[model samples]
Target: MKVVIIFNHPYEGSYCNAILKSTLLGLQIANHQVDVIHLDKENFNPVMRSEDLRAFINKNPIDEKVIEFGDRLKDAEHLIFIFPIWWELMPALMKGFIDKVIFPGVAYDYVNASNTKMKPLWDKVKGITVITTMNTPSILYNWIFGNAIQKALLRGTFWKLGYKNRKWISLNRVKMVSPEKRKKWLTNIESNFSKLK
Candidate 1:
């Protein structure tokens, strides 16, 4: 499988980084080809400029970065997103990636003669998995916050793009978890990813 892992975190030593490493290890053990996009390290611009919006509207190439990211996404069969849930949402960088890269011609196409319908272009993509960590309790985040990331990504984006097999793994109360528990979580992530085929 060709997997593209999008990682959004500023610190290299954070638990999110550990999760990324574990995920890579598991994918490697399964002999899957993997590519990683580290938004912070790449200094990805999260702000969408007016020119970008205009180009997108005109069906023109937005920029080189978006084109490159879109190419990676185009080639991948599986997509994995690793990030921390901040205030019930993903960071601005990840959101910007979605806005800029998953544009009209890339991820979906407007159905001709229909303003409300779109046909998904990423038909080669089999599945999408989102791994998120939060400082809040799982139940509270799910019930109170309505699992914002899951709903937004799975329902709003992936499903709208025509992908059906999606999984969301949320690690809650991350700040309160002990080192041992964190390690165990890493093991679980590795085990889960290793089974992907």
Candidate 2:
């Protein structure tokens, strides 16, 4: 299977990187072909320009490497997102990736004036997994903010894009976790990554 990991972190020592490494190693050990799209290293701009918006609305397109990568996302059999949840939301760079790359006519299609068809891309991508870190506890965040970010990615985007099997691994209260626990979490991530199709 071809697995794509979308690594969305600026630094190398963060939990996001740990997750990426563990997951990639696991996939390789399981004999799966793995590829990575490192957001920060790719120098992807998260900002949406006024001109870009006009191009989008007019059916023209932006000429960024990230957008091209988004086109690549359609070819995966399994998709993974490795990032951090900051302030109960997705990181700014990941958010930008979604905003700038996952555009109309790519992830999905809504065409015609009267005749309408909702077509989903990534139909072959049967699995999606989110490996995320959060400083707040799940209980506290759920009570205060709920799972908006998870829902947006899983139920909203992945489901709409026709990904059937999805899993979300959120390491909550990451700032308070011990090193041993973090290591254990990474181990478990390796196990889970091996199970994805």
Candidate 3:
């Protein structure tokens, strides 16, 4: 399968980076072709400008970066997102990617004449895996925050786009954990992802 991994983290040595590396290793073990998008490293502009809004509203391509990312999404069969939860939500860059790349004409199209219903365009995509890390406990993140990231991505985005096999893996209390525990998490991520079809 062709897998596209979107990584959002400013620090190269951060735990999120380790998770991304482990995920790549696992995908390689599965013999899956992988394409990685490092948002920060690419200096991706998270802000949606006036021209971007115009293009989006007009159902035209937003920009070159968005077009490139959209093309990658179009070709991929699996999508993986790795990032750290900041302030109980995803970083602005990732959110911006969603806003910019998943445009009207690219990710979906209106189904009804009234435009009340819609259909997914990227029918090639089968599964989506979101890996997130946070300093809060898992229960608190889920119960208190209502798993905002998962809701936004899975329910609000992919589910609406006809993706069903969506999985969310949250590594909670990351800062409070020991190095050994972190290592174990990496191993677990690799083992689990290696089994992905």
Candidate 4:
């Protein structure tokens, strides 16, 4: 399987980076071809300019990086997103990647005459897994905050794009969690990914 991991973290010592490392180890053990899109290292621009909006309206992308990312994801068998939740939402660069790379001509297309209905274009993509870390407690994030990440990414974006096998692995209260618990999470993540086929 060709797995694509979209990783977003500015600091090298961040927990998200640790998650990326564990995920890579797992994919390697599984012998899957993996591609990591390190948004912070690449300095991906999350802000959409007027030109980008215009291109989107035309169903075309002018940014070379966006086009390149789209091409990389064109034949992906599985997509894994690793990031931290800031203010109960995804980081800016990850959001920007979605806004720019996961566009109409790249991820899906409208099938109806009114352009209201969409069908996915990435036929090889079987599933999407999102791993998020946050300082907030999981219960609060889910009950009070409404699991915005899942609703926005899984339901709003991927499900609407025609892919339904979506999963979210949310590690909450990272700052408050015990070191042993964090280590356990990393080990489990690595083991689970290694089991992927």
Q: State each model's CA lDDT, in order.
A: 0.87, 0.78, 0.88, 0.90
Better of 1 and 4 by lDDT: 4
Candidate 4 has a TM-score of 0.97
| Least well predicted 10-residue stretch by lDDT in candidate 3 | 112-121
**Model 3, range 52-128, lDDT digits (tens) per residue?**
88887677875788878877778888899999999999999999988887788888888877876768778788889
TM-score of each: 0.95, 0.90, 0.95, 0.97
Off by over 4 Å in 4: none
lDDT tens digits, residues 48-100, model 2?
88987886775546656745786777788888888988778887888887776
**Residue 74 CA displacement from its true place in model 1, Å:** 0.9
Model 2 misplaced stretches (Cα beyond 4 Å): 111-117
Per-residue lDDT of candidate 4, residues 85-195 (tens digit)? 999999889999988888888777889879999988888998899999999988899899998998889989988888878888999899999999999999999999999
lDDT of 1 by residue, 115-151 (tens): 4677777667788999998899998998987988877
- Which ranking of candidates, highest lDDT first? 4, 3, 1, 2
The top-ranked prediction according to lDDT is 4
In terms of lDDT, model 1 sits at: 0.87
Candidate 4 lDDT for residue 41: 78
In angstroms, the error of model 1 at 41 is 1.8
